[model samples]
Target: MSVQPMLKVERLTKTYAAAHGPLTVLKEVSFALAAGESLAIVGPSGSGKTTLLGLCAGLDQPSTGEVVLAGESLGRLGEDDRARVRNRHVGFVFQNFQLVPTLTALENVLVPLELRGEGGAAAEKDAGELLNRVGLGERFDHYPVQLSGGEQQRVALARAFINRPKILFCDEPTGNLDGDTAAAMANLIFGLNRERGTTLVLVTHDLALAGRCQRMLKLRSGAAIDGEPETLAGAARGR
Candidate 1:
């Protein structure tokens, strides 16, 4: 039997009302991601890549269409219920790291598990393991302010994986890193996906990073366009 998609988006659309009237950011976008698959959405700034990610992760509601994550329809859930679904099955890595300034790296990594009522020594142990995996083992006691951009991002990555989420969504995860560091981070992400069979949805401007994904969808004028084979090849070659 064929496996079902971990995420399914049908005719998704989003609109914003500005002084100029209405602005449509996403236009009937549709796609499906199979379990353990990785896909990248590539687009220029303001092209709605981030908007699409937000809608898919239920962080924002679409003006039309439906988003089903792990078989749960986000359109049917209220805001609170949508949040619950996200906490249960979705993990996010943002471009800015989004670590708590007051918390130490280890504590930041532990926050998600704690929110899920998975606290105590066991959770700490797991958090530590995740931090170590991200090469931040020695910086566990350091606060976000004390770490470099790359280090803080690693901490965020660790936190995102703390729950072993079925689907992980990342937006410009390596945007702030240098080229070498970005490559390392990409390797780590791919390694985790391979090891845990987690589905990945990444929004990126980096052609090299996008190339590593199994599929690439380019966004233009609030819609996804199929990337040509040569485009994929060029991305794979880090052009």
Candidate 2:
């Protein structure tokens, strides 16, 4: 028998009310990803890539269609139910490195576990090991303000993996970092992702970054176009 997809979205759409009329940001987008597989969404700024990601992650509801994530039908859930499903199965990394400024790196990493009322020696130990694995063992006590941009992102990476999430969603994960720092962060993200066997759904405008995923979904003016990334076409032309 074929395995069920870890995430599946069918005819997903999102619309917002504008002064003129209804503005549709996404229209009938669809895709499915298996467990432990990685997929990239690439699009220009106004193409609604972030909106699609949010819908898929259960952070927001779609105006139409369905999102089945981790075997839970998000469209049928209330806000609390969706949040519960997300907490149990999903992790996120954002461009801004959404760490708590006042909390130490270790505390930040433990937030996910704490939300589930799971804490103590074992949880702390797991958080510590994730920090160490992300090369932030020595900086566990440091606050986000004390760390560089790349360091903060590293802390975010550790935090994302703390709950041993089934899936990870990255939104412009390296957008704020320098070139070398971005490359390093990408390596670390993919490394930890593979190590933990987490499904990855990454959204990035950079073709090179999107190319790293096993499959690529391109969006244009809010339309989904599933295919190989343009980078492959460019490579073929260059050769």
Candidate 3:
């Protein structure tokens, strides 16, 4: 039998009230992500990629439709309850490394555990292991400012994975990195998903990175299009 999807979006739509009238950013968008599957979303600057990510993650409410995460309907939950659910089941990585400057790398990773009321020796041990997995074991005590852009991003990745979330959402994760560093980061992301069986939903414009995912969806004018999987597959075969 087929396993249930970890995330389900049904007729999802988002609209905002503009000066003139209602502006729709997403219209009847729907998709499903099975456990441990990785999917990439690609679109131009104003195509609503970020907006869709936010809605999927329960960080924002949709103007219509429902988002079911791990079998729970996000649209029906209140803000505090939604936040609780996210903490329990979701992890997020942003385009900008959102590490706190004052916290050490290890401390940054540990923050999530603390927020979840998971602390002490076990939390420290797990945080250390996650940082090590991201190739930052030696830089554990370094503050965010003390690290390079790539290093900081690694730290952010570590933090995101600290909870061993069932689903991870990444928005333009490698956007600010150089080509080589971005490639390295992409490898690390895929490696982590493979090892941990974490479902990944990523928004990116990098064709190389998007091609590595199991599937790709392109957004245009607030609607998602089923992209040609062969486009990425051909690129892989050529390489």
The local lDDT score (0 to 100) that residue 58 gets in candidate 3 is 96
The whole-model C-alpha lDDT of candidate 2 against the native structure comes to: 0.89
Range of the 10 consecutive residues with the lowest summed lDDT in candidate 1: 227-236
RMSD of each: 2.6, 3.2, 2.4
Each prediction's TM-score versus the true structure: 0.94, 0.94, 0.94
How well does model 3 score by local distance difference test? Answer: 0.87
> What is the lDDT for 86 in model 1?
89
- TM-score for candidate 1, residues paired by index: 0.94
The CA root-mean-square deviation of candidate 2, after full C-alpha superposition on the true structure, stands at 3.2
Off by over 4 Å in 1: 227-239
Q: What is the C-alpha local distance difference test score of candidate 1? A: 0.88
User: What Cα-based lDDT does every candidate model obtain?
Assistant: 0.88, 0.89, 0.87
Ranking of candidates on lDDT, top first: 2, 1, 3
Q: What is the lDDT of residue 11 in candidate 2?
A: 90
